[model samples]
Target: MGRRVIALKPLSKENVTSFYQWLNDPEVIRYSLSLFQKLNTEADIDFWYKGVLRDTKTLSLGIYVDEEFVGYAGISSLSSVNKSGEYYIFIGNKDFWSKGVGTEVTRQIIEIAFVEKELERLMLTVSVPNQGGVKAYKKAGFKEEGRLRNAALRDGEFHDKIIMSILKSEYKLS
Candidate 1:
């Protein structure tokens, strides 16, 4: 089979429903920071989308696979002076899990950050237990910087998080 078309596109109001459904899905947000947020309404998602649009330092995009919205990825807290930002991603569609989609998304984001944006550094935090995320980040050339002890609380228990980062100097453009 041929590889599915995957692209990061500007998010729109049309995606509010999908965002709401994914945010409300326990399985979807199990390993996501969305678990701590209270975006319980489509309006809330819409508001978030607007905020991202207005935020000059933030760039968020919907992850589309073959013309369907499957997930989202973004970079926030961008600092031009420091040339760094915090990277984030989530594949809300369960069917897409374990399909190498995350790795592809990560690589695309890296290219945008390093080449287009000319950012020198990008970092991310992943729950220690989210092996899939950790592996995907590593596969995209992010190296572990350190761990925050008992940082994330999932299912009433605290879990550690690993901080990983990649620098423009280290990223070899393909």
Candidate 2:
């Protein structure tokens, strides 16, 4: 499969409902740990939809392949005490998994974080088992900064969270 990379468009009400439906599935929520775990309710999803449309520190993008919405990428947390934006993304459609859509979406998100947002840094945490996510983070110029001890509990076990970061000054992002 090939790759399709582009900017995130504003989410419309028409598309928002579909996004909510996609996120309700356990499979879609598995790796979206960086964001809140659940967005199943209409009020929660609608409120979130309003937030995503005009967030200053965080920019949201809709990901598409062959004109179909497959995922989303966000650079957010500008108001965080950490003084840097955090990256979050999800490719809700399992059919697009392992096909390189994530890497492309993330690269653009990182690029915008540095160049457009003028953020000092970008960071994200991934579940221990999300190897593909870790690899994509690395490919987008992030380094394995550290791991959060027993950060996430899934199924019957605790999973350490992998923390990755990229510095704006260190890269040609800006």
Candidate 3:
């Protein structure tokens, strides 16, 4: 198959079902902090969606690949005074994994957070077991700031969360 063009658009109700499914997927949630909690109902999903919409500090976007909603991306925990934010992205479509989609999504969100929003820094926390995610963030200019020892409990065991970040001064549009 030809490579599908990737794009980012504002999150809307239209993509909520896909978002809901992605959040519930074991493989997808395994790398995320959400793995600690169970999201079992559509009502729970709706509540989360509404929360995202109501949160003034977050800028959530849908990840599209040639007109198909494949994932989600966003900047949350924004602080105007500190000029900082938290970055997030996930490709719901398993077919797109390891295909540079995550990296592209990360790059796009960084542009929006730093250049468009003029945020000073963007940071994220990822499970240490998610090597692909860590590498992708590093490739997108995020540096390892520190580790939260035994911060996450998953699959009946405790795991570390690695904090990574990039500053506006360090970002270079490529």
Reference-based TM-score of each model: 0.93, 0.83, 0.93
* Per-residue lDDT of candidate 2, residues 1-174 (tens digit): 554544466655566776677768877787675354667787887888787786776667788777788777787677445658889887878888998778777877777777877777888888878888887778778888899998887665788998889998766643
Model 1 off-target regions past 4 Å?
34-37
Q: Per-residue lDDT of 6-100 in model 3, one digit per residue for the tens?
A: 89998887677885677777787777646316775788878777777778888888888888888888998989999999998878789889988
Output candidate 1 Cα RMSD.
1.5
Give the Å shift of residue 27 in candidate 1.
Answer: 1.0
**What are the lDDT figures for the candidates, one per model?**
0.87, 0.76, 0.85
In Å, residue 48's CA in model 2 sits off its true spot by 3.0
Predictions ranked by lDDT, top down?
Answer: 1, 3, 2
Q: What is the Cα-based lDDT of residue 131 in candidate 1?
A: 94
Please report how far candidate 1 places residue 7 from its true position, in Å: 0.7
Query: What TM-score quantifies how close candidate 1 is to the native fold?
Result: 0.93
What tens digits encode model 1's per-residue C-alpha lDDT throughout 1-174? Answer: 888999999987677677778887777888887432567677777787667667777888999999999988989998999999999998989998998889889999999999998999999999999998998899899999999999977778899999999999899887
Candidate 2 residue pairs in clash (backbone atoms < 3 Å): 8-61
Which candidate model has the greater lDDT, 2 or 3? 3
